[model samples]
Target: MEGSKKGYQFTAGQERFRNLIPRYYANSHVAIGVFDISNKASFTSLEFWIQELKRYAPSDCKIILIGNKADLKEKRQVLPKDKLPWTSESKHPKIIEISAKTLKKPNSILDSIASEGLAVKKARTLKQEEEERENERIQMYGEHSETPPMRRRKFLMCGSDRGQRK
Candidate 1:
């Protein structure tokens, strides 16, 4: 709660955020962590949220680092510290600067978010592969029935030879 300082109201804002984030994480496939580049307090708050998530996030989770409020370019102050693959400083997270006010490079944010979505897709694929192997193991031991669940078969097509959909 940061509102205690100079009517910032970040405390109220953060409460509203904490309430909404879990529902979003549950209903959506992706989560984004955003912050204001010109406002150090906002960035600090984002860092706190990231730390809280580390204990509960799944292995497949993806996180994006952003430096918003690029319109306040003269006031920029945050730094990247999380590991990101695209960043030359791989030890630090990727940070993109943009502003909703002047709309400076806002599309870059969308592109970064898309990259995170790609990571999630890969995670789901690996999970499906592991499940398939488990199914195969069960079949080898003769514990499996005539077929796996139709839903699990998904593209396998229990008896049909239609192959997988493109």
Candidate 2:
């Protein structure tokens, strides 16, 4: 059997990868910018990545800056805990350092990601349930139903929970 001809378009960019950002930006909820601690050039490109994410990703998108190769401190060019000066906004991106080779404990970087993911999941679930309940109430009584009391929503963060008006 003769195979049918198929074609695909793939985009390639330099290390900064500015071209790929627009393709995935609209649907992405999280943007992870990974850089090597042993390479100064990779670390320097992080600001450009952040700028692209801010320009294309949704306003509520969460950004994470990671400094990899933590185990290779002997060859390190960038400090693991260097503070980023540009992310001083209200919703600052999370900064984390990790080494794939030297993770020993259960409380590793993956654990942190899981916990944060759980919080975001819980918040979305709660919002969905609230919307369903509201819809049910609207269906039962006509459009003139009394407005329900507004409840304070609890937003979960890395290690704390904060309240926000809903």
Which candidate number would show the highest TM-score if scored against the true structure?
A: 1
Candidate 2 C-alpha error for residue 90, in Å: 4.2
lDDT score, residue 76, model 1? 71
Please write out the lDDT profile of model 2 over residues 30-127, one tens digit for every residue. 56677888998887777776887789876655676677777898999987556565667666678677786876432655555555545554576697
TM-score of 2: 0.57
Error of 1 at 12 (Å): 9.7
Deviation in Å, model 2, residue 139 alpha carbon: 5.0
C-alpha lDDT score of every prediction, in listed order: 0.58, 0.64
TM-scores for candidates 1 onward, in order: 0.59, 0.57
Error of 1 at 124 (Å): 1.8
Worst 10 residues of 1 by lDDT: 1-10
